[model samples]
Target: MTARLNPDLLHRPGLAAYRLSRALALSRIGSWHSYAVIATPRAGMPAMPKGYSYRIAAHMGEFEAVAGVAGVDLAVAQRRLDDGCVCLIASRGAAPVGVTWISLKPVREDEIAALYDCGGRAAWDLGLHIAPEHRASRAFAALWAATGDWLDMHGLAWSLSRIALYNAASLRAHARLDAQLVGRVQALQIGRLQWLRATIGGQTTLHLSGIARPPKLALAAAIMV
Candidate 1:
């Protein structure tokens, strides 16, 4: 999780290519891009910012109940349920208003499994979001505060997550929590051909390589559900 960017390359001529790549990936003959975030679990369960109720999904039924309010697809929710991933939910009164998932197993998304490592002391944090209507409140912070408590209880050392480069809001949300950028991944496609460039431990630079097929889901459809 301590992976650092290659400063020399990034500060030189690489910055332009990095920023310009987003435009080239706007179509089918486009690209896939994401960066990974790593954060250590902080102690204490701070009060849910606005008195919103916070709790963990103990079973599939709870996960399903929160799916709609959480704005997560039922199918996607079920897969996470089966994988033993836990969802932290915050409700405004009787309505579920925010959700976040914690996974101790491997990253289910194939595009990134080959790049970031997960398991043991490190856990993968999937979607973390507050409903559109509840965005103006402190529900996002409350949910994260709840997550820190949960992670500390489980003895986890690090929380890892991936966000699409284009998703500025999600990036800022995580950055506000003091997350460190530890991995870089991008896939450039032209018609039927796609190439991949991702973080490989021990390497300090991004290198593009050919791939037979691209992943069906590059990362989260929306940085958060």
Candidate 2:
């Protein structure tokens, strides 16, 4: 007889609720937590393949390289996620083969309200990631598919996903899932010139011509709409 493996066996139920609560508390304190679940294809592949499993991130530098490749500053991202948790999917006994980060926020009506006019709806925002070492494996795709399932189970069918304009791999993956590009975002930075200054009527005026906001880093949104 062929044995059927139940995926539910690997789930940490109450933990999700606890994390969400913690996130809420942090948000109240002006901090946020990124919450994401590891995406696995199926349980028949064997719970974690002896060394493969999922866990939460304990360090900031671990994501530095990946974030750099994507042209995103981790310092800025941390504040955006409100100091959220980063959940990782690992291979070979849980050694962090890849990662998925999630931020729970309200779907802005100004952004997705138009969807209602087009016979669609709004959902949650998700940030996904995978390590370089595990890029060749089925980890990324599996994680994506699993993420959708998790969203559905959580009663979030109208979820939204965002990908950096420079990340071709992510774009391709989302394309494979039939995610449509909706909009673009630009990133800009601004810095003050401390050394140069002009005295005008006893008021110091700094000459800052190149001191402009950083370029807008484009972000494309995709949804089932």
Candidate 3:
């Protein structure tokens, strides 16, 4: 019998494309091993242990849960989920404790040069999130650390994660990981006078990116999620 793929899996672009490439590469060299490990020897609070694992965020059930909370419509969420992004979950004895989604991609050549022009080389953007209940847990730290592990293991030398300026928790978490606040970006949106007048008079949110510092914490950073 053929190994059937999950219908939800079919919706992810990064997986749909990368899976084929990864499969061919695996046939010749290595196979994905992380999920099996993730499913094994579950921890009480932190589901993921210190080790390697394959990562992706295209699973439908997980996707829907997050989307529902974030108020993202089903179709849009599915489209992005199909893209080159990933979602991670922390489970305890068959109970889901937490989840996070992330994307793995290289900094654009222009962005790379921009970083170098500013005295940097490589970077990746992290826009995924973890559930609120799991905050401050070992699982949260493990996942953050695993993100770096995935980048290094996959040869994406340098990586970056964006965090909001107002999110003290994330700021502190990344700081623990040794992430640095590189720069900030502004997002603009047109809205009702009521909301705009109360906030920034029609302005949007400003974000910051924190980059990894090699085998340590995230060096450079970007502001998105």
The model with the greatest lDDT is 1
TM-score (all chains, Cα) for each model:
0.71, 0.42, 0.45
Q: How many residue pairs clash in model 2?
A: 20
Better of 1 and 3 by lDDT: 1
User: Where in model 3 is the C-alpha error above 4 Å?
Assistant: 1-55, 59-76, 106-128, 131-133, 191-225
In TM-score terms, candidate 1 sits at 0.71
Cα-based RMSD of the predictions, in order? 6.5, 18.9, 19.7
> How much is the lDDT of residue 171 in candidate 2?
47
- Candidate 1: list runs displaced more than 4 Å: 1-27, 43-47, 110-116, 189-194, 200-225
- lDDT values, one for every candidate: 0.60, 0.36, 0.36
Superposed Cα deviation of residue 48, candidate 2 (Å): 10
- lDDT for each residue of candidate 3 in 28-52, tens digit (9 for 90 to 100): 5422211100000011112245442
Point out the worst 10-residue segment of candidate 3 by lDDT: 33-42
Q: Least lDDT summed over 10 consecutive residues: which range in candidate 1?
A: 216-225
List, residue by residue over 1-225, the lDDT tens digit for candidate 1.
343323332343334544666566554356554454334335323545666777899578878777766667777777777767889998777777889888776555534323334635466777786788888877877787778767777776457676665555565556666565665566555555555566533234444434543332222211121
Worst 10 residues of 2 by lDDT: 110-119
Model 2 agreement with the true structure over 42-140: per-residue lDDT tens digits: 211222333344444435655554453222357644643453434333433434455555433332111111111111233333445556666687665
